[model samples]
Target: MESHILAISGGGFSVEEKAFIDEYLLKIPRKQEPLKIGFIATASNDAQGYIDEFYTAFKTEQPSHLTSKDFEALNIQEVVNALDIVYVGGGNTQYMLEIWQKTRFDIVLKNAYQNGVILAGISAGAMCWFETCYSENEEEYEEFKGLGILKGSLCPHYNDEQRRIAFDNWATTQKNNILYTLEDNENLHFKNEKVVAKIRT
Candidate 1:
């Protein structure tokens, strides 16, 4: 099974103008009838407003929210296996990774991806899938190691002045590793670890 990942720099359920991106994600899963979708809001600390927005946006499909709390009672593998697509929300990248590691949800996601589940996200959510990610820390941005599901580095929110400047400066210091950048309305589609398409919505 080929793995599919859609990395969005910004905009999604959180913004009304980018709802098309969410629609685009809905069409990626092979199973069209009664599509099963899961949302991971760990990056936002499982914020209720974000989760509510997801439910509202994806009401057409069978959408469920998966939080750190779920790790305590549900079998992570079983939960992930039931879904056709996993949508991750954006927030603090470092904090999300820490929680995912502690709960081993990161391992479950890798297995799910290998099994042909479509992984999609925006901002920090998008950065989590790459080998290295440029993340915001206080007043500045820095590089942070990711899950390595995809090679090279990812810089989200490229349209933002500060983020673009930070990424540009950081790119100069690195000799290897292709740097993938995405704007607020752009997305990069990766299949089997290779970029297959660039989407704009």
Candidate 2:
């Protein structure tokens, strides 16, 4: 089975600026009818507004929002197994990872990926899939370890000078490692841990 990941630095459902990118995401799954997509809003603390936005964006698909509450009430593995795509929203990356780990949703996600689920997201969501990533915390940019599904480091929002500088400094230490720097409108599509396409919107 091939694992697919579309990591967008910015400009997805939340921004609603680049519809084509989202269209590309929706088309990745081979399932044509009843293509189930799960929206993970943990990064935003399950913000209702964000969830509503997702619903508005993919109303035809009838995507389901996977919240922290669902982690306790539902069988995570089963829920993940039912989806063709898992799209994570952006916010606090560290907090999101902590929640995912505590709930063992990370394990479920890994299994889902291995089973050929399309994993895609933007900003904090995009950064969470790599071995390491540059993220902003309390106004300061820093490096943090990621889920390790994808090799190398990812720095989202590279258009920001501070983040770019911080990532550049961190990159110096990670010599020989592949580092992905993405601007607000850029995206990288990976299959089996290899980048197959560089997209701009």
Candidate 3:
């Protein structure tokens, strides 16, 4: 039961990112229960209205065709093996990686987050779940390519204003991974893969 990821920061939604998704669902791990949520917004359907305002903040339960054009007619390995928490909203990262690789949904969302589910995303769906993404709409900054399920380089619409000068020019290039900058109710949690916590709204 290893699941936990939160990456918010889009055009809206932030009461401290809904109090960090209610303290990141009380840090999960409570008998896994019937918590089968999986709202991968396929990139801004108004992020399914911020996943229906996160069901008034936590205790998950989204599923009734929650946008991404209904996950472009689902079927990505049965929607990541009937998910357990996969929230990915935010908009237009090359049209949400062209409809999430035309419904391939990035190999069933990285094999349902390495067989434990629980993956989050925001702002261009947390910059395409990182692995490289700096497309500050041309004019110089650019680095595309993602869905590596986190491993560096994801600068969502941080501090707005057209991505605050491209996240301060990708925090001065010379990249080599690790570069998250999702302000507007900041967040950065990862479980089995590391990064325990860093939420700041």
* Model 2, span 74-188: residue lDDT tens: 6778888879899999999988988988988888889999988899998888989988866778788777778999988788899988888888887889877888899998999
Worst 10 residues of 3 by lDDT: 10-19
Q: How well does candidate 2 match the true structure in TM-score terms? A: 0.95
lDDT of 3 by residue, 38-141 (tens): 56555554444566665555544444335544555546567666767776666567667766788666777787777877777667766777777776443555
Better TM-score candidate (1, 3): 1
Candidates 1 and 3, the one with greater lDDT: 1
Q: What would the per-residue lDDT of candidate 1 be over residues 1-201, giving only the tens digit for each residue?
A: 777999987778888833878878777775649789899999998999999999888888899988898866567798897788999999999888888888888888999898888999888889999888777866668788899899988887888888888889989988998889888878998988999889888
96 Cα displacement, candidate 2 (Å) = 0.7
Using Cα atoms with residue i matched to residue i, what is each candidate's TM-score against the true structure?
0.95, 0.95, 0.31
Compute the lDDT of residue 21 as modeled in candidate 2: 85
**What lDDT score goes with residue 141 in model 2?**
71
Displacement of the residue 34 alpha carbon in candidate 2, Å: 3.5
Worst 10 residues of 2 by lDDT: 11-20
User: Model 1 clash pairs?
Assistant: none
